[model samples]
Target: MIRHCVFIRFRPEVGEAEKAMIFTEIAALKERLPGFLAAHVGANVSPETGMDKGYAEGFIVDFADAKARDTYLDDADHRRTGAKIVAAAEGGVQGVLVYDLEIPD
Candidate 1:
């Protein structure tokens, strides 16, 4: 199994309403695409005592393996959702970080 995580930082100028819309679109991807074991998207809620770089939203996706992950990346539904995210991204901070790891248990 693989756990694919993405960290997204929205543009500072984005508003709450736009953020909600982005979140909704992201949440809807699993239903529209195949090869997804699980999917979730949310805003960062971590308390900033000292080490917060101000990342805004994030997504988590689980797949059977690298093949599934690659397929998901090119799927029509995913492409559509990703396009929406790119269009809505506000500032220079709107970035994505992805990590894939095998399940350890």
Candidate 2:
């Protein structure tokens, strides 16, 4: 299995409406894309004690293999959703991240 994780830190000027639209678009990907074992989206619940650049929301997507993952990267729905989400980022920093790995089980 491969895990694709994303972290998003919104620009301070971003309002609730934009955030909601972004989240809704991202959540729709699970049903639109194939090879998705699981997809979860949520805001950071971590207590902001001493963290720098406190990110807002994050998501985890599990795929069966690298091929499936690559397909998702090329998927039309995923691309459209990504474009909307990317537009909401601050300075194009976006706080994006990803990890790919196999799981033995």
Candidate 3:
């Protein structure tokens, strides 16, 4: 299994509606792709201050394996959605952090 974790620092002007649309686009991919297990999206709720480095929002996507994860990466819809996220980010792609974790089953 693989966990795709993405953290973002959205531009100040990016509103809730746009954020919701981005997340909605991401959520819809599960219906079309195999082994795209689940997507968890939300804001940073940690009590600690400054730890997030201004990345207040993020999402975690679970995939059955590396193949499934790669499939999602090559999807056109995901490319578009990722473009949107980059656009909404504070410093374009630099405002986002991605970390992938592989889990043994």
Candidate 4:
């Protein structure tokens, strides 16, 4: 299994409504993409202070395998959604962090 984690530092001006819209768009991808197992998204809720380093929100996508993950990377809809995230980020793409973790079955 592949765990695709995305942490975002949204611009201060971006409001909750817009953030919800972006997350909703992300959640909607399960219906369109193959092997997209699950998606978990929300704001950082850590008790520790300053640990988020401005990345106060994020999402995780679970894929059946790397092939599915790669396909998602190439999907046009994903590309469009990615663009929305970049646009809302603090420094374009710099405000986003992507980490992929491989889990044994």
| Best candidate according to TM-score | 3
RMSD of each: 2.6, 2.3, 0.5, 0.7
For residue 56, give model 1's deviation from the true position in Å.
Answer: 2.5
What TM-score quantifies how close candidate 2 is to the native fold?
A: 0.78
Model 3 lowest lDDT segment of ten? 19-28
List, residue by residue over 36-74, the lDDT tens digit for candidate 3. 999999999999999999999989999999999999999
Candidate 2 wrong stretches, greater than 4 Å: none
Task: Give a tens-digit lDDT track for model 1, residues 3-104.
Answer: 998776666676778767766766676675556688777877778753435556777888877788888888776777677666655543256566788896
**1-105: candidate 2 lDDT, tens digit per residue:** 888887776677878887777667766776867777887877777787546356667677888888888888998878877776667666554455455667755
Model 1, residue 18: C-alpha shift (Å): 2.5
What is the per-residue lDDT of model 4 for residues 1-105, given as tens digits with 9 covering 90 to 100?
999999999999999999998888888889989999999999999999998999999899999999999999999888898999999999999999999999999
lDDT agreement of model 3 with the native:
0.97
Q: What lDDT does the true structure give each of the candidates? A: 0.71, 0.72, 0.97, 0.95
Best candidate, lDDT-wise? Answer: 3
Q: How accurate is candidate 1 locally (lDDT)?
A: 0.71
Clashing pairs in 4: none
TM-score (C-alpha) between model 4 and the true structure: 0.97
Model 3, residue pairs in steric clash: none
* Structural similarity to truth (TM-score) of each candidate: 0.74, 0.78, 0.98, 0.97
